[model samples]
Target: MSNLDSKLPELMRQATEDLEPESVDLVERSVAQGTRLRQRRSVLAGTAAGVAVLATLGVVVGAVQHFDRDGQAAPAGSLAVGPSATPKPSLPSKAPSGPVATSPSANLKDPTLTTLKSLLQGPSRTFSMPENWGGKDDGFFGASWVVDDGKGGSRVEVLLERFKGPARCAGEPGCRTRPDGSTIRSESLSPEYSDARQKEFGIVSSHVEITRKDGRRISVASYNGVSEKGTKHTRVAPILTVAQLTKLADSQAWQFPAKVSK
Candidate 1:
């Protein structure tokens, strides 16, 4: 053998002379330590996941408890509260059933009222005067009647006054001058309201006004409702038509007393 080959065994013995020998349990200890580390990491991960689940459950239970204490609930995502927090539904109100208010002079008696009721009588029709009239002492007299036919009830009002001359037809619809030197104005299913009450009631009227040559004026109005105000509409249209109102206004029974006939 060569000299270097002969010295190799001594060199190896010198290199290992200060080193400790390998332990028989070294590989087993290494395997057990690695397994323990892996299990610990798995347990930590499982604990974090369980904490998240418990946190979510706590939030849900807290929200439900809060709602139980109060009628209103906090908004969660897009979820809304129940109807217990909302206003209750209400039914529509009915119109008043009391008599209509009027001027203090409404109770005054006028001889002219007697004649007007007689003119309104007809088959299947009944008429009654309400405490809603005035102008008995003045030259003008106004009165109203609640008339009912077999179909429904309606209000028919009449006003007898004095006019300066034949009405100027400007802006007045269906106005015409009769051959008797009288002017007549008629409206068909037209709205005429003097105050908020009449407007709120949605009153529509069929009206006729006549200005005679004798300087006396007659106004006849029919309403779709039982009264001009404080009532709902009982029919689709007024009880009397334009033609019927015109005929009523043209009657001779609307005259005042002889002294005030001017």
Candidate 2:
């Protein structure tokens, strides 16, 4: 009796082995689909968490700008985030302080240019000229004066030169040197620019030269005839004594030009 029962159960298992294959395959497919759905749900939850974090940061930045004095006082390290203002340039209210540039030729105006307009008035003084004589041209270095003889004769003149080189013509004819390094000279000549100058306007000149300790030399000359036939040609000889010429040369007036030139 027990053998038959056990044999009957074994026969039933053998009959279903081939027949259950389709049902077993359907169950396995359902289980794999459920597993794939769970994996997809997990990845979706991670992506959703990332997106929420980025949204929270954007909201925080907006709130900070709203409280930052209308964006005027932006937070530190925020230069790249705003339209910053550029500074305006300002002008100076006063002259800029600095060294002023100067040149070798800037000379002050000398008052002698006006004071010596009328050289001599009436009588001959130490060194004198006619009343009509005045300064024709003058400069920081020298001057020229002239007078008409009232006889169609050559006009006389006085000329000054400052800073002459090493006292040349020191002891020529009619020249003398003093113990104080001062020199005196007298010269007479005839201009043969044709016989008329030689006869009517022979030239006589008296000069005084003084050299200072600083290698500065001043020369003053008085001419008895128009020295500038080339320019201010007066065709008459000037009237003055050798003593007068020497006195004029020794006068300090010649230094005014040199003083202002510096």
Candidate 3:
């Protein structure tokens, strides 16, 4: 045997020689201490891993909930993912009901209004006119037409009046100048202000009135009904545009004055 191996029991006896005999029995206690330390370390590691997993889960859940409440969408593993719903179509607005377009037509002329009885001359008759006139009426100094929109329901009347009054534009709307240097005002009549007599004619009406630099005024109204007492089915959309009404209202025939043939 090697020297150290053979002297191991003698060395143990020499090392324990200074200790009391009652205090030397520690082999079982050392093993128990080592086992307890290993168990405590293992439990601490397991607890830390569990806390980490819970923290990760909390972040994921919070992120998912935030995205859910927001306008944007979350990924597939998120809570209750679904496609966005489409919005429903809304209703159309209440528009001024009328024909899309008035069929092409020429100004209708009554024999009396077809000619302008000029003060300078006897009767000057050269003036542009739109055809398809339903009918015509001659007044003392004004003239009117049924604007002959064969459709009926709305009686689009075009009236040319020798504005007997001054060019008062203080309370008017849409006042502007035309290419011809005449001041014109396009006015819309409120349907709500319609009296019982006015309702007999139509729903709504508009007019174009113009005053020349010479203070001569001419008025034209494209109405829904045939006349102040015309029916609704007489015509629709007043059968004309602002330009057309202004042209008719400011016709040289009325500006020059005939003695507007009734």
Per-prediction TM-score? 0.52, 0.36, 0.37
For model 1, the stretches where C-alpha displacement exceeds 4 angstroms are: 1-109, 165-173, 192-202, 258-262
**Model 1 vs. true fold: TM:** 0.52
lDDT of 2 by residue, 58-177 (tens): 788767777575856666457546424432221111111112311123222423322233343233322222221112232223333343435333333333334434544444654556
Best by TM-score: 1
Best by lDDT: 1
Ranking by lDDT: 1, 3, 2
lDDT of 1 at 204: 77
Judged by whole-model lDDT over C-alpha atoms, candidate 1 comes out at 0.67
Candidates sorted by TM-score, descending order? Answer: 1, 3, 2
Lowest summed lDDT window (length 10), candidate 2 = 89-98
Model 3 alpha-carbon miss at residue 126, Å: 21
RMSD in Å for all candidates? 17.8, 27.0, 20.9
TM-score of 3: 0.37
Residue 250 displacement in candidate 2 (angstroms): 0.6
Instruction: Sum up the clashes in candidate 3.
Output: 15
Lowest lDDT 10-residue stretch of candidate 3: 88-97
